[model samples]
Target: MTDLLRLDHVTKLFPVGGFFSRRSMKAVDDVNFALSADKPEIFAIVGESGSGKSTLAKMMLGNEVPSSGQLSFDGTDVAAIRGRAAREAFMAKVQPVFQNPFEAFNPLTKLDEYLFATAHRFLGASNRGAREAAADAALQRVGLSLSEVRGRYSHELSGGQLQRIAVARALIPNPKLIVADEPVSMVDASLRMSIVNLFRELRDELKVSIIYITHDLATAYYISDRVIIMQKGKVIESGDARTVLEHPTQPYSIALKGAVLPPDPAAASAIIRQRQVVAG
Candidate 1:
């Protein structure tokens, strides 16, 4: 179980005021967590908007550099990764699935092109035959296929389908760690679980570790093996998903748990009725 990622007192600060003022704000403050290379699991970064979970995700993706502390991947410093080849190598192992699938894809470009391009870029599938094979195989893992997506535009597919294709593109790289920042937020309610469940399949079948960043506690509790609750750029609670979410010790965590809707419709209706009576 080698260290896949390590963050030693990591912090990210952004300039707030004008150049004259020189004021700065902390986006991610003293955060630390590690995922093992061999033991892949779904790790959720749970928080609301402005909690800095997305910033943390960006830092992990190397799109943003930390202001202080060490951010390492596989024992190498992420900020120190210099040159296109080194960065490309790092990208091959770590991929990103953004919140909105439509925004991630080009409306004009054919869907298959994105898949084939990823296969070519990361997996080095130069020839059309090899590229198509790699693309189709990756798509199949996400319950989609090249035939379904080929020659289709982003607008042609449903949000769920586009998101699945996004996952497949990430999979084409054979990545060890995927930083999916609110991957299912833009998807429809009925399809949300399918996308959430896909992460479990990815961890179990493909052995890919996931960094699932989202504000949805229900989905987090459903999928995550481990979780870290973030509040105002700082971690409030961190532990096993079941233990922490079910038996939350922190005040905020407890409040969050109370907000989760009941699974049973009858029970949910009862709560709603109770709330209505209280309001009345």
Candidate 2:
């Protein structure tokens, strides 16, 4: 079988300097990777701020186009997908869960409205009963029920609940791939694991391939099957998540791993003291 998604020598450039200036900066530089349609796994794109991870997510979601190379999904070129019908068809197969759940929905809108609308649009759940059933099923997959969110507003729920709703909304389409960018970054510390663990369930049970974009190496270690570490818009390392993160050879990769604080108090304290000594 062909790959579900393929980015072959993909590159994106942005014009820099003044309006008259011709210089350009590469946001994504010749990145190549593929996800198998036969297997579903959590593929992590790890990087710090301005590392072009978000830019890559945008390109995968069709929100932005690459300046060079090709992006294909399920054997068709993403850049060539034009027109309202084609776009909607593409959206049904690929969905996106954005970074901030607070900004993803409107405070005035009822939560179920979003889910119901998704069902109606993508699932062809034209009747109220059909839409409600479709929405309820998707909500259940994320550990939510229709009664829990039917009339609630964004402000009425915790960040974790709202983010789960966002994931549930993405699921209503039964997408082949989900591109989630910094999903748990805005949630509370107590609830971060809930969202991270939910992604694992999404892959294992639903067989949905996910491109998880995050700066949190700890959570990436906990959930990802494979990881690609990016720096200055380039992939410096790629391999099995455990192998690359636990025994990274590159200086930058090692530094990133060292940045994670150990769970044990004494070990963490010693690491902090070592850093303090280095600074002195």
Candidate 3:
């Protein structure tokens, strides 16, 4: 089957230093992947800071163009999408959830405004009644409702609540794909799992394909169907999430797995010993 999204040898480069001593730094280097149109699953891109995961996400979202190669959605080149009509159509199919929920909205604005605007713009809820109904329905998917956040400002809600609202607003368009960058990293530890589980529900129930970009391996192991480990702007390992994580082939992947200490001290010690043996 043709993919819903495909990145064919994509590379992004940015210039650094003054004009006289300019040099190109490759942010994404020959990256390639595909997501099936009929399949909805969470695909994780895991790497530490400066690994080019964010660059890949931005290219996928069409926020940035690749210096080389093609990025296509539903067999259409993302770069070829031009004009208001085309961009709007693309946006209706793809949405984003940022890491910081607080920064996603205005402190002074009512939370429902974003929700209503999304519904009105994408879902075609032109009137008050239609917009309200649409907003309420989308919010319910993320375990929230317009009533709870109707007149509330961003500062009033907890981090978890704000993140859920962000998810709700993204769902207002019933997008086919969502690119979430470190989505749960900002929420409280107690509530992180709930948000992770929400992504699972979105994939299984709504059939929405998700590109879940994060540095948290534990949550990536918990939520992703497939995982890609990146290093220095290149994919080091890519395969089934559990298999790749549990039996990582690359040295970097092995090191990453070893870095995640088990909750129990005894188990953690055992893992450390095992990793030491592998290293030896």
Best by lDDT: 2
Which should have the higher TM-score, number 1 or number 3? 3
Candidate 2 on 105-220: residue-level lDDT in tens?
Answer: 99889989999999999989999999999999999999999999989999999999999999999999899999999999999999889999999999999999999999999889
Screening candidate 1 with a backbone cut-off below 3 angstroms (N, C-alpha, C), the clashing residue pairs are none
Relative to the true structure, candidate 3 reaches a TM of 0.95
lDDT at residue 139 of model 3 (Cα atoms): 88
Q: lDDT per residue, candidate 3, 63-95, as tens digits?
A: 999999999998899999999888988999999
**Models, CA RMSD each:** 2.3, 1.2, 2.4
TM-score, prediction 2: 0.97
Clashes of 3: 0
C-alpha lDDT of candidate 2 relative to the true structure: 0.94
Best-to-worst TM-score order? 2, 3, 1
lDDT of 1 by residue, 30-112 (tens): 99989988899999999989899999999999999999999999999999999999999999999999999999998989999
**Residue 4: error of model 1 in Å?**
0.6
In candidate 2, how many Å is residue 267 off?
Answer: 2.4
Worst 10 residues of 3 by lDDT: 267-276
Return the candidate ranking by lDDT, descending. 2, 3, 1
- Of models 2 and 3, which has the larger lDDT? 2
Model 3 lDDT on a 0 to 1 scale:
0.93
lDDT score, candidate 1, position 86: 96
